[model samples]
Target: MGAAEATDVESEYSSLVDFEGPDDPSHPFNWSLPRRVWTTAVVAVLNLIGTAASSIFETGNGQFMKEFGISHEVAVLGTSLFLAGYILGFLTFGPLSERFGRKWPLLCGLAVSSLFDLMPALGHSLPAILIGRFFGGLFGVAPVAVFGGVLSDCWPTAQRGIAMALTVSLVFSGPTWGPVFGGFIMGSSALDWRWNMWVVIIAGLSATALCVVVFPETYPPAILRRKARRLRKKTGDESIRTASDKEGLSLQEITRVYLIRPFWLFTTQPILALLTLYQSFVYGVLFLFYQTYPVAFGTNRGWATSLEYLPLLAIIVGIFVAAIGIVIHNQLYFRHHCHTPDGVFIPESRLPPMIVGGILVPIGMFWFAWTATPAVAWASPICASVVIGAGMYLLFIQGFNYIVDCYTTMANSAMGVNGSMRSIFGTVFPLFATQMVHALGVARTTTILGALSAALVPVPICFWYWGDRIRAWSSAKVATF
Candidate 1:
């Protein structure tokens, strides 16, 4: 009789502990429009600050080389090591967000990263600067690793595309913006490379402070756990608990969730593997441009140091234009699929823009490859960068949305896997970027890049037509809707 009574109590408690209803005001998805918009913007800003730290130093590479008496190759380590940190942070933070929640992990990461940002700003030796830069990147990537999940938690699938576009544009543009600001500082007679580090430190700390005040916890499980704890105190019933409370936090569970699962999904999921590799290629090319841009605009065209970084703005312009297009398209076409009764839209619905983006990338690369010479008008290559930027943005935003849609619950792990590869490529590509351009010449170097991008142009198109079938073969739990 007692066992039966306990079973009845447990059943009643489970229902009580869930969201009051789908419209529960405490739920992130049910938050007010203004709150959601502000949250999304704040999250985007955090990502921007994190990624911007990686390349701000590049603008002052010349000064850094002179100050430290290091070779150009050694100086490049500052940027490469920062990217390497992305891999570590992504691997660690993604699962941490899954287990713990988004807000605290994100907050802790930003705070620590900001503290480390001081390494580059005040380090008297090259080793200190490099170590600081690496750790800064390692912790800073928390936003990059987990913001996708935050946005996922806040926005429903239908409205997510535009929000994602706005966020990703800022995220991708961060590296370019770093150089833009750093250039003016480096060009100033009073400022030097350290000022760039200071700029990152200020931005990072400011972002951390802002998030602490405004950011709300978004992860569903984490939020529910908190609610369960509150109910337990209010009712004095220890049985008031969430499903997650029953799950073990053992070492084996941690290892499986953090390490084994991500690797398994990365290897076994074909759609994930192919898209990840394509995105990695695109990412590597973007970093490669950091090295090549100086050579093309400053060295070959004899542009002023302060002005050379200005052309990279063309990428930002393209990113802005592409973002608007994505938002508009999502409103018109993609939103319909998301409105389905089951709320299970085909993930392939996200691929059309990616197809157009794929075509644009190679065209822009080839156009810039041949026209980047001094004799050619500078505006020609700048215009080409616009195309490249637009293409890259489309690929980035759509690919990310597709991954999230395909693997609904496991999106964080999938993204972490994808981010790790992208970071690896971003890290290694620049180490030899200068050598590649010098040996192959600008035309040949860019031509090779163009060729690589062109080869993958079919990726989105193939996925568009046959993605449903491809997704069918996945062993992991894919979204059925």
Candidate 2:
């Protein structure tokens, strides 16, 4: 009660409040399981909506072209621009999350993205719709950046495989189902191109509401740092400090971390560099197919309406089937042996599924390209789509797991770089797809893509064999198994 005693107590409290670091239990990884799962689910849902927005308007493209009196290429820009916005958004959001914490940035991004989704419905002008789509993609990238980080934050390496599988499944499902659902909606006499945007907006709003209500802060450093600040304020002590507070890089330092590290990893680590290139190509091919499919199915086959291609839902079914195979492979790998020589029991050991995916990519492409003729049964291209989807899911899931495993704390930055590369390809692929198909025809164009995909198959095997050496030589920091 004495003045001296009160001063001493205040000094003690200040010290306690200053303490911060990785070991703090308040971090998201240390949260109870139920809370972490809820956070992960919210992130997955947000990602679903973001991806859904990417291609939800595919079925509506013809309608827009007619309504706006625009060329097919110009209308397709709406889809391409959304992806470009995602690329632009990735550059900012990853670092922002690192600085401010995940919750606020994610919420703000989702709210804005959802609002943009509504803008397309408000006007008939092409510019307005394009602008709205661009902004939606811009905000949508927040979930893309944050979701992987959230998984890294809450789940230890062991449990991350299944969590990642599920997250990725949801993300892919959005785009996969986008066209299917869009077809259904557009097929309905009651709806038009605008309905596609509304569907996305509704989905975004629902996900955002759930996130706001159920998701809690999960980043450990941010949580503990806040707790330390509060404790300091209340107790009037000075000694307590967090590891992050003591060693936490300044904003400039963090920026340096983000900018410098990925390049270093890409340049020095052949594995990363090659993987980035390969995955970039795969992504390009995937988006290219988005443009190509309608041409092949709707135009070439003389499907009376875009809705006739609804049977292409078989592609998504293929992806889900491949996902099941991935899960089975993962379980089998774990059951046999769980640890590497280094004594690290990495769940990354389950990456063998990628090999299956690698095989599927080229095979599916070749099949679809060759069979995409009016003379052939429509079933031919649909079957090829199944193979391509299966292959894509396999490759994507493996690549994601590989990166997350390799870059533990820095996974967000790595993913941002990967996303940037992927988006660059996504943006470029659509622009040239028509030209490519025109020049080579669907079969030859796809044959080239398939061959390119085939070439990359060996890359993963090389990584599986020599990944350790490559990681050692690379300057970029990676988690050791």
Candidate 3:
């Protein structure tokens, strides 16, 4: 080759490796479509496995109570501890991901969580199982915090609605299917509760393996840092540097961004604060149903065996079917009206499905509570669960998408804060589920939750109307609509 041609080629290569600005092609936003989709799928699978493991043990709570000679409240701790661990995990892992990068932390967490999943299978004691479950959740937070960040890194704001909808749908669907499968496994005389843990452990292992294989490094700063390191190594010159090294926060500064900033946003932003509360309450109610279903179907309604309660699968199917309409709407809005650089139309468009979901939630709860009697037939309550599940997904989809639209650059941090609060609710709600039903009766207990649901309907209305003003008032960083 001629010297001039070689010089020109060198200039092009140098420009590609510069990585000095927002326009860098190495950024995750510029990754090829196949790579982006594969990364998203891996993250989604990790979330699904983590969530599935959280509630799978609940299906065998009866056997756990029998074997451990513990009260219902104590046996419930197996589920509660998992959520508590997740709460704590979110606080720690979210910031940690910002520091060390997404891949290592997620891989380490999945490894630790998988190990914890196996521990309960080996230990016979209740306390051991509880401890193991708690640690499992703690490690499992990696997927929850990192997945949204991964999505934000790859997908544009307009396209993210459908991607996030799929992710949340998988997360919600995981716990529902876990018990269905767990019931079948535990119902077999040949296997016991240990099989539940084993099944989850196997699934976790499979997901972890898939993640390690298919998931590439998506975080842009981390990629550039690695490139800088390689350049320094090859040239033996100390001047090589990444864009992040020049402009990014120090470890202490990043810590403040990850830890303190979320609290600031939580306290100062009315929209974030209110949405957090509404989402937490809905999440709590959903977790309550996890415990309530076993009691309502198995004990109160005279289901003779483990298999008899399997009709709860209908609720899951119904939820998926109803969620499809919301997904379709999200896709349609994005295709037509949601095209905006500043992300205004997306948030406004989320309100319609959210309003419909809010109405369905309370109506379904009332229906289930009133018709739970054996004489009414089990289908009555199952149908109610369908409505509740559908409503829950609707609220979940809107809340999540709204947050993503509002906080474009800091979406992961916003999700981390919201996730911590939701986990706290998940941890607390199941403990009182049985007592609430017994003291107030299912009809009254659920009516109270339904009333709460009804009250929250106005939340979306307020957001739909005054959302622009609220964002304008916020001190925390958010997109201007």
Candidate 4:
């Protein structure tokens, strides 16, 4: 039927179930503040554990090499394959959350990923450990992939900045702290490298339990669907149906809409495509540090092996500091120009922090490149890492905020493209990091990364000036909340 015919039929259905009004307490947007905050915190913790698992294996490389009689390059696959698995997870789970709901996909993924963690924890062979890490990343990605949807569900654009900052901070901090935790775990005289995987299993299962007990269904359509069912049963009216009940796509339609749409958005939307590329590059640089940090602090300075991962903590501190900056920006700018007199939200308001972040990324890289020498005090490079950390955090959180604001309802698909692209970079960057440092030297390798980031600084700056026009140029029929 045509649109008019469908509307006429929907109006004829007196038993249709929906939220009573905009302020209905059953709607996720109308949920109490404490409940929303608690849900966001739970999702963030889950994201931390999933992303942390991506890098934690690096600290166990020595054990892997010794146990398997493999070279360092070969052992790096444990990290690389885990990241490769993230691409699969993003592609699978991000859209699934849109179809199913956030809660079950997240809980199920966490539980299964925890089960896979046992493969690495208990397996004796290298293949078993590597395969387990890959599957663990695959199943563990629901929290990372579906998080933006939860934020969009529970908070309005006006109040989402600080939540995004705090959550994304944990997202990045997970990887930054992973190796640190793994370092200590591996350092234990009694614990083997397998203990690292065991930690992931413990954390994953605990997070799942918390979500099962605390999290409610936050997706609007999913909630409406359930409400429709409840109303149908209570009133003995089989005609009770939600608007989502009308959206029964066929198998081919489902494939095109959910599976193909993200890749299409990534390729067609110039703004999304370019920003995703920039985000991917920044993410790649982060993984590069996993390889280069040891060289800068340990190999060159003669620091003990276990102590080398400490510099990563500087990055974590910068992440929280950037979170504070985002909160301030929301208070100062969002309150002023969030909407025009006509009440159209200004998505460009999110760009200023990202612009500052773009500038700081290259600056920090250059600073670290020059100061990361045994001749200089160790504090200098560590401080540079702080700058890099702050810069990366702002870039990541604001980019997400911008997409969530701009795309609104389609944010999950946009994020799926984003997560997959960055995971690709995250997977590939490290495999060459050690080689790049060996060939170019630490200063030169870092200088090259700095120059690359410098070239992309125009992205946010240009978007700040012309994002409205760029968004207008898009033909996609994206629905705004």
Candidate 5:
């Protein structure tokens, strides 16, 4: 009788799922393809909304100066403060995901970020606007810190290439798109720059609601824990536990692991250090283009304000074209090598295109720089923007994918660290962009940037050849490519 009772208890305990096993329906990895795509799209929109909040206020710079009676320097601090919030946010949100799970942290971030998005419009003072922007950015961490992990959780290694392609395309294109739409809002005679914040508020609300309605819980351990809890309650036993729960994590331990791991990875990992430097510089240059594009096309070329944003479309075109090219390349070269039976994909597979991009960045920069004179056909320099855009977009995608591969399970933290530096660069570079052009002239500024781009050309090549060796040295314990 005792033996039979023990057998009953053991059989009951087996009902709780702690990890994904073969053909487990509850595992995100085994979710339907349509469900995964929908979730990814919602996550992408979340990214678009949060990131757009960072720069939709770019148009407000001149107006803020005019109305608030602030200097150009002080007015530009709006951008700085918004991005500065991202720096703090990216550091904490990923760690938060590790502890609380991806769903709640992401929803909370959107809600808080949306609240602050409207503050700039409501408050009448410069201090109020700046404070709101900083908080808005701080709270907008969900898309940046959590989305990469969501993609990792839902998609396998092979499918992640195109999934990330869609993601990076939307993300890289967001800053450029912000000014395009914001210019229209700012251009309206009936309204003022404050409406830009209203637009962002609306976008945030839409994305957040879709997130809540469409995206279910994605973190594996979190799902299992809920299952375990259900089993415990159903069976009148308290012993039910998930694999993650088995670790018995404390708040202090989670805080340390999530908080310190990113900085630790940044400092200790050579791959992250070099890639961060390169990605940050290129990302900074992207924001600086916002300063340069208006000059090169608007004032220098005498284009209408209504039509000035058309040049940016060329950059957008380049971004999508590069994305398409990558998708095709993945099919041709990566169909087999990108996936393995054990779910490992090749890391260096992301590098060939990066090599091409490294070369194109300087080429387009120089092409646009020397030919930017009014006498030259605008088409020449405009076409050059496509090249530069493609190069920048390609580098971003490759760098992001390579790092994700290097640290699969920890991809979110890897991106968080990468994004923090990228935010820093985005914040600092724009502050000086106009001054650089003013001091050196557009040609010299572009040429100098091109020179710097040329100098960093070896980054992808070095990574392509020596990346395996570098990963071998890392303490992250990644699989061999």
Candidate 6:
């Protein structure tokens, strides 16, 4: 893996310089499975902590509205703007990881995010906390999208399905559990909403510390470039270059790729567009339920404070259950579909679970919405949350796996676009969820959203049928490693 070896290998290949060999120890793919598991676990934990920040703010939804003397929508701007910041952060950090490397940007992002996370705890005013939340979320982008890039760095496609399921499960389960902690904190008359901010700071800092102590560079191109640099210094051969070293972009080009290209891919690629839409709507509905949770339990059902937060557990359970279900489905249904007749990994089979999820989402939504009132048993809505939660997690599990499989080395860029778009949708949903509920009533509002979800059933269907043709038209520059 040294520069001299790299130079000799480059000379040997003539066409391209890849790892020294298929089993190059420098490659993450060649790492021991134990090491890969540890890396995946660390990245998953960071992603969980980052996503939790978004929903924990909602646990204090009541206090924020009252303190600022703002309307519900305006109060929602605290979490809304925080999520909106995700759009900005994602546009930069995930793509930045592609250009620079994963570890540095990830650590820098965590450091900046932790600082911003602490800001809200110190500030008393709503505008101040809103700004804090915005910056905190803005800086958290690395953990959100780049984790996929990290996972892709280590796990091969077959094992990647379950690894991604665990990552996606935590990505969601963290937020669902955040409110549980937030509820207990806010429930106490002595503790203020700021405690939620402090909790995130402590956790974010802890995760950052673990990352610094343990995280090794996983980006293969970055690793090879380092070796090339060393080889030049050792052999005095400035001509030695990793493939990525020769193909590297200037800052201007990198910036343009970051700024303009995702919009292009998002708008142009049928597979990316459809998957984004499906995940976005399902994501939006999850956040909407965040706003509606209190109304469903505390306001309508007259449940106690502690019990009101308990229902969020249904979704958490469903996420774990759905992760298991997807893993099982991958083993059974996708065993053959993952490989072509020639044994190359096929990415489109990732869409099958998504198709099943699309069907389940509307059914779950309709079930939850109609059974949500006090006239129904409380268990009905909570169980309905499970169904909705399972479907949402399934979509997420499949969506991330699908994108990674499709884009391969450029997975970060694709997921950056995917994450940015969905975060935008999540930001918009909470802002109007209460308003929608008020105007239409919870049952009618959720039912309407469910019907909207049902309308998009053809999205996954068409992708399953025609994904290869769509990929042939995609503009994404996928690198073969």
Tell me the deviation in Å of residue 15 in model 4.
Answer: 2.4
Model 6 stretches with alpha carbons more than 4 Å out? 1-19, 225-247, 342-345, 407-410, 473-481
TM-score of each: 0.93, 0.86, 0.88, 0.93, 0.91, 0.89
Task: Kindly provide the TM-score of model 3 when superposed on the true structure, using C-alpha atoms.
Answer: 0.88
lDDT of 1 at 227: 93
Tell me how far the alpha carbon of residue 369 in candidate 1 is from the true structure, in angstroms, after superposition.
1.0
lDDT per residue for candidate 5 within 192-285, as digits (tens), equals: 8888888888878877777687679999888888888888889868767665654556777666566777777787788888888999999899
Candidate 4: tens digits of C-alpha lDDT, residues 100-171: 888999899989989988988888877888899899889988788888789879998668777887888998
| Backbone clashes in model 3, listed as residue pairs | none
Q: Rank the candidates by TM-score, best first.
A: 4, 1, 5, 6, 3, 2
Off by over 4 Å in 4: 2-14, 233-236, 476-481
Tell me the whole-model lDDT of each prediction, alpha carbons only: 0.87, 0.76, 0.79, 0.87, 0.83, 0.81
User: Between 1 and 2, whose lDDT is larger?
Assistant: 1
Query: Which ranges of candidate 1 are over 4 A from the true structure?
Result: 1-16, 231-239, 337-344, 475-481
For candidate 5, report its TM-score: 0.91
What TM-score should be assigned to candidate 6? 0.89
Give the number of colliding residue pairs in candidate 2.
26
* Candidate 2 structure, TM-score to reference: 0.86
Off by over 4 Å in 3: 1-27, 30-32, 247-255, 338-346, 475-481
Q: 192-254 in candidate 2: lDDT tens per residue? A: 989998888888888778778777776766776778777768876656655566455766776
Model 2 gets an lDDT of: 0.76
lDDT of 2 at 463: 81
